[model samples]
Target: MDADVTDSAGTPADPDHRAGDTPQGRSQEEPGATDSTDGSEPVPQKDAPQDETPQGEATDADAPQGSGDEDKAESSDENKADREADGTGAQTWADHPKDGSASRRKRPWLRWAALGASFLVMISAGAGWWLYKKLDGNITTDTSAAAELKVYEKERPTPVVMDAQNILLIGSDSRSGDNRKYGRDDGGSQRSDTTILLHLAADRKSATAVSLPRDLMVEVPKCRTGDDKETREQFTQFNSAFELGGTACTIRTVERLTGIRIDHHMVVDFNGFKDMVDAVDGVEICLKEPIDDKDARLELPAGRQTLNGEEALGYVRARKTLGDGSDTERMERQQRFLGALVNKMQSNGVLLNPTRLYPVLDAATKSLTTDSGLDSLRDLYDLVRSMRDVPTDQVQFLTVPRQPYRQNVNRDELVQPDASELFKQLREDKPVAVVPADELKEKEKAQDEKPDDTGSDSESPTPTPTYSGSSAADDLCEQ
Candidate 1:
C-alpha cells in the first residue's frame, strides 16, 4: 500500500501522481520536456472547470470580481472627460475652497448693487431735467420790447468799461386782468409805479440801486405803442413814458436821462409783486403809527410787524396815511421796505432749501416780463449766479437827489450837480460814495466832540462821498 496520499482539501488525490500520468492512465507530457525510453505516447491532462460564464448568457453575480472594479474605473474616467469638455473641471463653484466660495458669493450681490445705484442716478437726473424745463417755461418774454429797443439801439449809450452791467427794473401798475382788482382799470394803460436802475460794478464787489421818482419831470422821447401808434415827444412825468408806450419807451427814457447803456430790463406787474411777497411768507416792516387807509386797503396797528402780500402792497402804496404825504417820503419808505426784504431773502435760509426756493423762483419768473436777452432760463441763471455772492451790506439803495419842481410842488426836478455827478459815476463804472446812515451820524457826533487840527495844515484823506440812503444790512425795525 502506498502512503495514504490526499489533496489539501482532504479529498482523494490521483494514484499515478508520481508516475506522471493522466487521470485516464495516459502518459503526461510537458512542453519542451524530453520523453523516456519507454515507447508510450504523451497525453495532455484535462484543465479544471473555469469560473467564467458562457457568452451572452451571463448575470452580474457570475461575472469575475475584478470586472466590477474595471467598470467603476471606466465610469470615473468618462465623468472626468465630461467635466473637462464642459470647461468646469476645476472651476465649478461647489468644488472651490471655502475662501473662494465666499468671494464668489459676493460677486453677484455687488453687481446687483451697482445696477441699483445706476438706476437711481438715472431717475434723479431725469427728475432734475424735468424740473428745470418746468421752471424755464414759466418765464414770459417781451418780444415787442426787443423790437422797440432795436430801433433806438444806435442812440443808446455805449458801456464805459467791460463787465459793468445795468439792469432797469420797472414795477408796472397795470390795472388790467389780475391787476384790475388792485387799482383803476382804465382801458389797458399801465404806468411805472417804481423804476430802479441797478448798477453792478465791473469788479462784482458792489451793487447800487438808484430809484427814480415817478413824479420826476423828464423829457419823453417819441415812442410807438403796442398797436403801432406813435406818440409825439414831449416833456412829461418820468413814468409817463410807460403809460404812453411800454417797457421799451421807459428804457429809452432812462437811457436818455442817465446816458448809461441799459443791458436788460424787467417789468413786474402788481399781482406778480404780491405773489413774490407772499412766496417769501412776508416782509417785516415797522410802523410809527396805526394805519387805516381806505385807498390802499391797509389796516395795521403801530409797532414792528410782518406784513402779508396785500398789506405789503398797501404799505408801499399808502403815501398820505403812513408818512409826510410827499412822494419823496414815500420813496424813502419804499427803499426801507426793499432793504428789509433783501435782508430777509439773503439771511433767512431761503436759497438753501429747495422747497422754499422753488416757490420763490416760480413767483419771480412768472411775475417778470423780461427783454429778449434775459428771456431764457440759462440767461437768468447765469445772471443770478454772478451776483449770488455779493455782500448784502454792499447792496446800496438811494434815490437820485431831487427837489420840488419850480412850477409844481407835486412834480420833482433832479438836483443839478449832484444828479450829474451820480450819473457820471455810474456811467464810468466807478464806485458810488455811500456811507451807512448810522456811520455818518456817528462821524457827525465825533466831529462835534473833537477840536479842529488847525496848526498842522495836513491834507485830509479824500472822504468817501456819502449819499442819503439805507443799506440792505441795516435793520429797519431798530430804534
Candidate 2:
C-alpha cells in the first residue's frame, strides 16, 4: 500500500519514494486514511492515489530526495571554485595562462624542426673543418731546398728592330719519388719537364703561348747552391737552374736568355694537374695519328677522342715516333693540346660546379710553389677573375719559330727573319700577322734580297726576350 506524500516545502510528490516518519502525530489515523492493521508503515509514492489531503503538504519522497540533491549541489559548487582558483578548466588558449602546457604544445613540431636543422648545420661544419685539417696534414712545405738556390743576373740580347716577349712556364719533374714511372728520371738533377711561355700584347688584345722544348740545348748560368757551409756554384743545363736555385734561378736564366720580363708565374705538380683535368670531367681532342707512347704509359687510337689525365699528359709529352720525331714537333702538339684543354674546361662547367672545382683548386694550390705575390688566396682569386672573362678564341698558342741547328744536328736554333718578326710583335703586344701565304712571300723576298748566296750580310735574328720581374707567388691554383 502507498500513501500520498508531500515534500517539506509543500511541492508536488515524486514517482519513487522511501518510507519515512511523518511530521504529524498520526499513524494512518487521520480521517479517510487507509488502515494499517498489520502494523507496518505505509510507503508514500507520487504515482499512488491518496485517501486524504493534508494542508500545505506535497510528496514526502521529494523532501528526502531534495536533501541528497542539496549535498550534490554543494560538492559541484566546490569543484567549480577549485577550477577557478587553479585556472585550469575547459577553456581555450585565449583564457589559459601565457606559459600554459597547452600553449607550449602548439608549436612542438616547429621547435623540433628548428633544433634538427641546427644540429645538421653543426655536423656539416664539423665535417668540413675535419676534412680541411686532414688534407692539410698531407702537404709538405720545404723551403730548405729552395734556400740552396742561387740568383744570377746576366746580359740578354737587345732587340734592335723588333721587341718580343717570352714567358717560361715550367712544370717540374723532380720526380725523384714516384714521378719517375710517369716519364724519364734522368738521375742528374731535378729539371723543368714542361715549359710553356705565354706572350700577351702590350694592349692585351691578343696572346701567344710558346712551349719551350725541355730537350733544347741552351747555356745555363752559374748558380750557387747552399749557404757558406756547403755552397757551390756551377754551370749546367738550363733545367738544372730550377734545382740549383729554385724558381728564382730559373726566372733569372730565362730572363737572361730573353730580354723580356716575366710578369707572372705558376707551378703545379703531377697530382694537381690530374685533379684539375678530372674536375672538368676530362678534355676532348681530335687525334689524327694513333699514339702508342708507352713511356708515358698512354695508348690511344686515332679519331675524335676524350682524354683523361693520363692521356692528356701523354699527348703533351710524347716525342718519340711522332710527327718529325723532333722536340720542335712535340712543342706544337703540346700547344694544340693545351688549347683544346682550355676549351674543354670552359664547356664542361668547371667554374659552375663548386664541389668539383674547389677540390681541384685545393689540390693544385697545395702542390704548387708560386711567386710570393700570388701565394695569398685573395691575390690568386683576383688574377683568376681577370682571366675568367677572356674568351677561349682570344687565347692563341704558338711556338718560337726554330729549325735544326746548322752546326749541331741534334739541337734547334731560332728560324731567321720570320722568328725575329714573331718576337717583335710579342714584345710590342701586337697581333702576330702569321698568315702562311703572306709569311712565305716575305721569306721569298728576304731570300731574293740576300747580297750574296752565302747569306753572310743578313743580320742574324735575335732570340726571344724574357721578363725580369719580382717573383710573387700569387698565381697558386688553390688560392
Candidate 3:
C-alpha cells in the first residue's frame, strides 16, 4: 500500500494542466522530494469545466489552498494564454475558414447583387433629374408671341374641342448665327420656311398634319411687331405674316384662316432640324433619281439610301432640283421625308427608351422656340406621352387644297370647299379619312377609262370624302 504524501506547507499536490506532464509518482520515485524551484504548487484542472473548456485552460476551483495572490496570478496568466492560443469568439468580414476543403455559401453573392441593384437605382434617379433640367433649359420660350397673342385675345377664336389640341409647327429661315452659312441675313428678317398645322384628336388615337403653302394668298389680321408697332390687316402671301410681325403675326393669320383656336406652337430653326435628323442616325428614303444640288449642299446616289443631318436638311429644303421643281412638289417631298422619320422613331422604340430618346430631345430642344404652354419639360413630356401610342397609320400628313392663282401664276389660292371642310373636321375633332394622292389619282383615271357597268342614272349614295394624303405607315421603299 502507498503512503499518502504532502508538500512542505502540508498541502496536497494537484494534477498538471495536461495529465502526467510531471508524473504523479515522481515523489515515490524519490523519497521526501519537493519542487526545487520556488516550492510553489501547479494549477489543478477542476477550476474549468473540462467538457466545455478549450484546451490549456484553468479555473479558480483548481487553484491550490494557501495559494494566496501569487498562485491566483499564475492561474490568470494561464487562462489568458489559453484564450489567445485557441482564438477569441470574434470574427471579421475578411475572415474565412482556415480549412482548404471548406465550401463557401452563396449568401455573399446575393448580398453583392442587392448592393449593385441599389447603386444602379440611385444612379438612374440622379441621371433622370439632370436630364429633365437640361431639356427644360434648352427650350427657348416664345414669351413675345404669348404676350402679343394675349393683346389680341378678344379677336382670337375660341377652342371648340376642349380636350383636342391644335399646334402650329413652323420651320424658321433666319439667316443668323449658324444659319448665316446658308443665306444672307437680309437685315435679320425672320421667315417661315415651312408651316404645318398639327391636330391631335381628343381620344389620342389620331394626329393630322396639314402643310400650309407659304405663297398661298391669305388674310392677315392686325399684328404687333418687335418695335411694338401694329401692322394693318390685309390680304397678302401667307409667309409675309412671319417676316413682318414674327410668330405672333403668323399665328394670327392661321387662326383667322382656319377659324380654329391655336393651342400651342413650336418654331424649329434650320440647325435644329438637321441635328434632330442626325439624332435618329439619319432617315432612310428611296429616291427615284439621284440628287446633286449645289445650292442645297446635297449629293447622294438614288435608290434606298440613308440621309444624314446635312443631306436630310438639303433634301427637305431643296425646291428647284427635285421633282417638277415646284414648291408644291417640294412640300410633297417634305411630307414623305417626315413620314419616314416618324416611322423610324416608332419602329425602333426610340420614344420608349430613355437613353435613346435623350439625344433626340436634346438636339431638338436646342433649336426649338415654343410658347409658355410647352416650355416646361413636364409639359412637353405629357404632350409626347399622349401621342406615343397613336398608331403610325393614324398620323396623317396632307396639304391644304390649293391651286395656282389665276391673277398671279407664281402664287397659290386655297381650293374653295375642300380647305374649309378640312379645317371644320379638325375643329370638331372628327376623323378625316385619307388615301395616298397617287393612288387616288390612279383610281380616278381608271374610272374615267373603264365603261360604267351600272346603267342606272339614279344617283348612288354619297360616300365619305377621303382626303389625299400619306401616313407614317406608308413605305417609301414599296413605292
Return the TM-score for candidate 1, rounded to 2 decimals.
0.75
Whole-model Cα lDDT of every candidate shown, in order:
0.78, 0.56, 0.82
lDDT of 2 by residue, 333-353 (tens): 666666666666556666556
Task: Find the candidate with the highest lDDT and give its number.
Answer: 3
What lDDT tens digits, residue by residue, belong to model 1 across residues 1-479? 01111111133336756664333211123321223436655333233234432223334575456645564454344445555666443222233245443355658888899999999999999998888888788889999988988888898888888898999999988888888888789997888999999999988888899999999999989999988999999999999999889989999999999999999898887777778789899998777889999999988999989998899889888886876898887877788888777778778877667777777778888878898888877898788767767888888989998999999988999998889889998999887756655776787789899997889778887565567787788787872
C-alpha lDDT of candidate 1 relative to the true structure: 0.78
In lDDT terms, how accurate is model 2? Answer: 0.56
What TM-score, computed on C-alpha atoms, does each candidate reach?
A: 0.75, 0.60, 0.75
What is residue 461's positional error in candidate 2, in angstroms?
Answer: 24
Cα error, candidate 3, residue 447 (Å) = 8.0
RMSD of each: 16.3, 16.5, 10.7
- What does candidate 2 score on TM? 0.60
Per-residue lDDT of 56 in model 3: 27
Off by over 4 Å in 2: 1-103, 128-168, 183-188, 199-207, 215-219, 226-237, 376-379, 416-479
* Model 1, runs deviating above 4 Å: 1-112, 435-462
